[model samples]
Target: MMVNDKSIVWILKIYLLIIFVFIFMPIITSVVFSFNSDRFPSLPLGHFTWNWYDKVYYDSETWDAIRTSIIVALSASVLATIIGFCTAYTDFRYSFRFKNAYLALALLPPTIPLIILALAMLAWFSKLGISGQIWALIIAHTVLGAPFAMAIIRLRLQQMDKDLESAAWNLGASEWATMRHVIIPFALPSIISALCLTMAVSFDEFAIAWFVSGLNKSVPVVILEILQGNVDPQINAIGSFVFATTMTLVVIAQLFLFTKKPNNH
Candidate 1:
């Protein structure tokens, strides 16, 4: 039985390794090709060089897209996190009629098809006379990212002790005081995690941005433009940078999420 278990463990490890390789091989290839001196990716990679990276760095259009993406991501993530915290707190603190329906609506955006969501946002923003503006992209991204933030914060809130708030109230704390002193501190890690995760989501998003971002293009939109024009080596370099940035944010969020102290109660 011991030998069988060891063999099974080895099999699982190998399977997991294979899965990771399948998922990451394309990204690894893009990173490797970004450093290659060759204009086109092929079997025999050209000499290792920084030419592609330099070109992407010096391109004004690339910088503009990156700046726009940063602004939109930062704005959207803040809005999303704020909205998420409020909705999560409501769910955590109260019970009302059609509460399940409220939760369903709160979490529904992410489940909808991105293209459909994008089209709907475009129509709505156009009616509001905000389409094709930076604010439009910000609003659309906020909508897309809010559900993710809510899910993350809600999970963390679920782990909290229900009686902590009651104890605070009993000790002469007002409702707002209990929230400020106890709940926020307890969920701070997850809140930060949600912020990072939502920022990453907004940074990487393309479809909605493409629809609403008339002149103000984000990084992903720029990438698509590059692809549409030609097979440029600069794309590999830019993709590598975007992937690195997004992965960093995801890693930071995951670290905060999983490193929280377990609830004793």
Candidate 2:
């Protein structure tokens, strides 16, 4: 038994190490390549420089794309977060018919192939005369992101105690007052998580944005365009910046959630 247990432990450890390396190898390679001084990706390793980073920062087109992406991400995240909060709150706080079906539908977007949805949206948009506009992209992104936000908020709401709301109501507080004063406070972390996740999704979204964004260019669309013509260190530089930004935001959000002062009402 002891030998079998030892073998199993070793196997699990090896498996975990392999999985970790497999997942991170591309990321590590990309980060390393971002600092490569050579114009070509295959250039030998000791040529490190800051030129690519400078180019990434200084290029007007790249900056424009980045600005566009940020605007779309912020808009879509805020819209999706609000829609998701309302959806989750309704499902949890009230009894309704077809609630299961509603939740299943909410989760369907992430499960379905993105290509199919993008194509469908493209067809619909073509008929509506608004195909390829920023509003089109915003609507697509909101639909894509709201489901995920709802699911996360629902999970967090489940973990929350309902007595707090009930107590607030019992104190002669109105429903709106209880929600504003009590429910929203407790759900802040989940709200922040949903916002972060939605922003990330909107920021990196490619397929739907490609279809619905029309002639307007976003960072991902610009990145795709850049890739079609040439392979440059700029790709790695942009990726490195995205990676760094994502990591920093995730760290800050986690720390804020975990270290926040508890609400003692």
Identify the leading candidate in terms of lDDT: 1
Give the lDDT of residue 198 in candidate 1: 96
Clash count per candidate = 0, 2
Q: List clashing residue pairs in candidate 2.
A: 132-213, 132-214
Give the clash count for model 1.
Answer: 0
Indicate which candidate wins on TM-score.
1
| TM-scores of all candidate predictions against the true structure | 0.96, 0.91
In model 2, the runs with Cα more than 4 Å from the true position are: 1-4, 250-265
lDDT of 2 by residue, 138-199 (tens): 88899998997887677677777778889999999999999998888877787888888888
